[model samples]
Target chain A: MWDYTDKVKELYTNPKNVGKIDDADVVAEVGSIVCGDALKLYLKIDDNDIITDAKFETFGCGSAIASSSALTEMIVGKNVKEVEKITNQDIVKYLGGLPEEKMHCSVMGHEALEKALKQLKGEKVEDHVDEEGEIICHCFGVTDDLIRRVIRENNLKTVEDITNYTKAGGACGSCIPKLEDILEEEAAKPASDKKKEETKKPLTNIRRMQLVEETITNVIRPILQEDRGDIELVDIDGKNVYVALRGSCSNCMVSNVTLKNLVEAKLREYVENDIVVHEIK
Target chain B: MERVVYLDNNATTMVAPEVVDAMLPYLSGKYGNPSSIHSFGGDVGADIAQAREKIARFVGADHDYEIVITGSGTESDNLAILGSIAYYKDKRHIITSRVEHPAVISLCKKLERDGYRITYVPVDAKGNLDLAYLKESVDDDTAIVSIMYANNETGVIFPVEEIGEFLKEKGIPFHVDAVQAAGKIPIDVNKINCRLLTISGHKFHAPKGIGALYVRRGTRLRPVLYGGHQEKGRRPGTENVAGIIGMAKAAELAMEHLANIDEMKRLRDKLEEGLLSAFKNASLNGDKEKRVPNTSNIGFEFIEGEAILLYLDAKGIAASSGSACSSGSLEPSHVLRAMGVPFTSAHGSIRFSLSRYTTEEEIDYTLKTMPEIVNRLLTISPYWDNEKQEGKPINL
Candidate 1:
């Protein structure tokens, strides 16, 4: 129905690694019985912190199942630190792309990866958060912080978009009114923030370009530097900011998405929403 | 695996050679407007008359003029219900089943927005219609009672003849969407005693874009389309001459092969029996005995259906899934959901429909290949705990 890419169809029909790892060092499961799709991830990490193997068990639609399988394939031989950088869009990119409604399936893959890493790091996982300021979407295990952040980052305007992205109100829909309130609050946020950023903008073109370079240095450089990758600001033409992806980042499968979503998104949040980032080969 | 085992016949059937032979003349040398004054065009009109007569005979309509040709099964359904409502002015209520095809169901929804009250009768767990509820829901204001003769998903045949008689007694018009039932089983419109009945050519063996609606003689109805007088001022448009000719040939073939349909039933039963016995936690959907001859809707627990369908597709075993993942909308089939099937099972239902072209060898291939795919998906499924799994899920 989604017009699934050949890769998604292939992996779903013949998944690479399935079932649980008997001696899996880090096991993390996300998604609840209330939610339609559920996924459990198992990671076998070696002494040097490289993931020796990974496997997954999923109960969901074609995209959910395929995303889980792709996630398993993605992190199998990578370091735990590098695995932590795997985003929802990375899984989506690995499978060509999922339908917008099925984007939550890719989000599940990202969360499963995070939960497993938290386990490996001896960090506490929220098994059941009944405390106040926690568990806003009880139908799903969606925390208030996650919902607020997704709302802010994606500039999500409605409860339906939130559901499509994070699967917050996709279940019983009891939390829909609550989600609407949160959405209202989040919607009012970026306008004031944008106004504040606009007030601080330099009038001169040279100063504006300098500010763009400084924003890239302060915000996007550190992220790419971690992956033995870096970015250099090439030029700024009006709203378009051109940058060359240096090192392993250029060869990375999902670097284009990272450039648009991660780099450009951060630039827009920090600088201006009108900024359109382009990779200089 | 190189060979295909097509089992999605309720979706569409392969055109017969004879039907194609009849259509070739209309497509090439005999292209003439039936309404033209030319003798060549008049001969085409004569051919259409003969074709109409054959289709009328096939459906047991009393008069050939009662058969009005339309663009498709969907158009025929739209034309019948909409036409009946147009002619019957002041009536504002409609009744249909929960599992009617989207052609009818969506139209009813649109009508509801324009101040029409529509009652959707539910079905039992086995996909059997609730006749008592249907009879009780009918009223003097009811415009038309549009119901499907057989379900496209589960192949459950409704009691159209009984319902038709009951509606006739109430002096209310009835429209039957027999697109799925027409060729697979007998359709006697006179015996049905309905105001209208619709059947598509492609469902039997003709090419797509051709269908006929049976308007009982003197059952006043309006046309959805407006143009030249092709179907006796009922469906006014230049005729799809080639398609109508093919449908006539196909109808003749369908009548000839009507008894041989039991062969499809035997293959379907073998396929259903083999799968049900071979796999644990596998079961059937709809009424086991009341279904059309060549359909088997099977539900396998713990795995989603689109994955299964894709796996089967990769293996060249054509089938259809009722899961939300298979549909454009992210909701499980309305038919399965209306039947009160559990979320676990409903999300995993697959419809394997056969035709006269099906073979035991194809069934054997399907029976052999399906369990392997099911077993693989089940192992990958989180709900299907291997530890709880018994000796072997698949008998083979």
Candidate 2:
């Protein structure tokens, strides 16, 4: 059985605002029955852009209902900005916590709130428009972009983690290969600009030589030699990788930028955190 | 607090008082090893033999030696499937249904990865196995056909007797998982004429962790576990004496209560009929006529099952669901999915199973209280279309 908090049990047993509003200022529907949870959030806002009342109609499990009810209670009497700042985590906090499997219910609550907030702003609800990415999971209608965004934001590394966060590939599991591909692409990220600044490892003489040779073969030389620009490993001392530009690179005018931008940046991905490539005349 | 109405017997059963009484001696005082040579220990082997004979007779097997006791139904299943496949090395095919329990289904999946061709015979929308497909799929190299006597989720009994006869004619070994069917209905290995049948003790009023496998006297099976001479080298370990004794007593009580199965069936029908009458947009999952006497898998549209289950739990009622919300996954039970149940209702499916101990008062209280819960939930359901007077089925 799920270890539900007493607050969740209380709110679930007697949800604050249920049923759709008659003449609401904004109505936002998120999710569908196919995904096993759907929440339609109804909002009644004042002239000053303050939410006077919030009601919800949901077709889902206990956590989903609890989350929608909790979302309604949290957003009522709060201004638009404050309501917008309330995230899925905020809703979960209101209910103490939800089971890890039921976290998607809170996410559904957040989606409904965001949609209602957008409608209140007189903006398009962004439903029925697959502008971000094509739907990969046909069962739940989850898009690749949604899956990618969840993976990036949560730093999720596996398809299972993606399902746990976004409900993507959780149903039918036919899109698992696509999810795997996206996970592989995300995990295969190259070293960033920030990483190229610092070289933390103190290198021994033999280790420095290994780093110099490895960088030349694996990183620095591959791209340069492809463009008829050859680089030879000269020596390494401390964080500096000394190299000689050969072939077309010898006469290249932009070799200075190339050495700093491509060579140094690429080498930092593999060899060390900080390694400056200096051309030896 | 109201009395706890247990309708989850398919999950596990309460141990009968008599079974406990029969097992106490073996559990405490009679702790001698059954394999020992001394008189004190050798006497325990006679008790083990007596229990085995009782279980063997309960399943209507001719000889008691054909029964091999094991830890649980899953162990018995593994022993039957893997053991037969090992004994028949030249054969490289397995046939089972799509709705078998995970114990059978997952093993078939592993066998597929090991380069053995496996045919998962599909079922109809009512969860009936496609026997023609099973016949067509069987070939000369088909190693074994493993089909359950009754599905755990739906309680739809398959025609295992008919299935066994045809498979035997094709010169193939057949194994029946009678774990769910043993105490609920009559099972005769001779009538089914299958080479192997597996049964769990806990499905009836027995303690958990004991099961039995019926292997025809001449059937060859390579043992999955190897240690000592217990279970005639088929299952080589010190036997669970207390558990086996409890199972034997459960089997005997099951025979005594066989005449009262009709009464349990009547109570089950009352619950099914009452729930159906009280709720709108609800439907039964499996075939109504072809199911066991005590299980009703129902789907209540527009509300998630876990939500209903939690409410029921609050009211001192016990039931279970294979719905997506009940399971951690977004898809419901594979049994429901394979039956082509639409996603709108499949997410709210519930399985209510009754046993011999159920009373009419409990059923009456459930029938009275459940409608209120359903009505309460429907008021807040977004899919409850008031104008149309029914919960609207969401277009997937």
Candidate 3:
């Protein structure tokens, strides 16, 4: 049912370098049978740091095997350093394309090659270690570092993108909130740095007013609109800005929490950190 | 050219030539509204009556009126479960096996969300329903108990007769989803004593849009749909005349070939035995002797099933898998997982289902092509190293 490319189908049927090199320079395996896909790569790297031969044994679906096969073909006769540059996207490109859900197969191939190079360097490599962060998704054993790296490397925009690339939050989905936190953090990385620069300057009274109005229109009002509520900037007096909650927010039980946590937080972040808000009842 | 061996009949069947022949006149020349007062409509109504008679006889129901033609097996299931719950407003509980088809399970889930208590009777590793749990779960508030006659994935027939007998003593309504069992095996309302049973036309040799629900006489059911007096106001709409005729024809043919079920069994056994023997790490997933004659679910260790299925597909052999990739999820088949099939093998499980039209040659082709495919995948599988490792049990 996966719309695998003709090249993927061809490579899966008659995968090249399927057997293992018994006396190889380095052997690296990634994934597990429990996770539904695993791959063991046997590499024969020569003295010049060039991969003389590469073979793989993969336990997974057709796309996984095809991705492994493509990885082997792409790495053979190439420098070990250059092989490190070949990302999962490169393997996907070699196979023409894989279904969005099966992109993790190509990621597995890229990971095996990375592990093989690390093993060839005589480093003590442990299987399944993220090398960047702790495990976040227990079902798939996807670490926070892996999720973050994929989000940054692939310019991932949604939780589904992370699942497609790294298989986080694709099972059980209990870690979905954690993945969302990571995505938000990664997405705000550039903006946060820019915010620090903008925060250092002294706030002109007019600039403070415009910034407060912009934050309300662009951020605070939209959040309140989700609950069928609205807010109006009644008046602004220096650090104290007076506002009135309208619609559903007028008599809401948690309107105070919304004002402090949502409204004041936006004002502190966008305007001066000392800005105070007053509700005009 | 490839041989094109179709072993996915459990998913859907090829429309038989005879069934098409029987339905052709209704599609064109005999296109009369069965509800009309004209003679043209009267003749069509008479044909529907005859079809109903044959279908009633096929399922061993007492009267033709017991068979209510619906759009699909899911509709019949909805009609039975929702209708029973609606009829018994004071009762707010339902009991169903964990492995019932999504039609029953999902509807139960919706009912649960609607403030109804649902007791999902678990099954053992062999896919047998926990009857003691079912008995314990039933209370005064139990509205109905819906269990499938045969599992669609594994084809493991449940002890519906025993369940029926138990529920009969308790005076609780029982519904049986017989979609997979209708044409493959014999079904008798008298033997099972079920209050309602569902059948899909396409599961046999009929077209896809027709199904039947057998409601035992005196079992009051609120109509799920309302329009006209079609299907005696049970399913109200214009009747799918040709589909109903085709289903009746399929039922007639099914009755005629009831004795030939052994032939299908023989082919299935041959394929199962050959594949299980060909691969040292392979094993059967469901109850070997208690399954339907047409189905064989096998688990091949180490390798994933979608890979094997794709390899088999390339060889012109069609099979299905319980693997996560095949199912469009990261979790493998829930049925297999519920059976406690380890993740290692559950991801590698494949199902081959046969039909009455299967040939021994097709079986031979599958037997010949399967080993090479498994062997090829095994060579690439890191776990396949001439030794068996008891796979770790997965929580999914």
Isolated chain A: TM-score per model?
0.71, 0.64, 0.68
> lDDT of candidate 2 vs native?
0.85
- How do the residues A22-59 of candidate 1 rate in per-residue lDDT, one tens digit apiece? 99998888774225566889989999999999999987
- Error of model 3, residue A214, in angstroms: 31
Worst 10 residues of 3 chain A by lDDT: A252-261
The best candidate by lDDT is 3
Candidate 2: tens digits of C-alpha lDDT, residues A1-281:
87788888998899999987799999988888877888888899898888998999988888888999999999899899888887665676678767767877887888788777777778765674222578888877777876776565444667787776668888778899999998888766645544544446466768766866876787778877776779887877778888889887786544654676567767766666467778898
**Ten contiguous residues with the weakest lDDT in model 2 chain A:** A190-199
Given candidate 1, what's the lDDT at residue B353?
96
lDDT, candidate 1, B304-376, per-residue tens? 8887888888889889988766764445788998998876777788999999889989999999999898988
RMSD after Cα superposition, model 3: 10.6
User: Could you give the interface RMSD of each candidate, to one decimal?
Assistant: 5.3, 1.0, 2.1
DockQ, candidate no. 3: 0.44
Writing each residue's lDDT as its tens digit, candidate 2 over B187-233 gives: 89999989999999999999999999999989989999989998999
lDDT for position B210 in model 1? 96
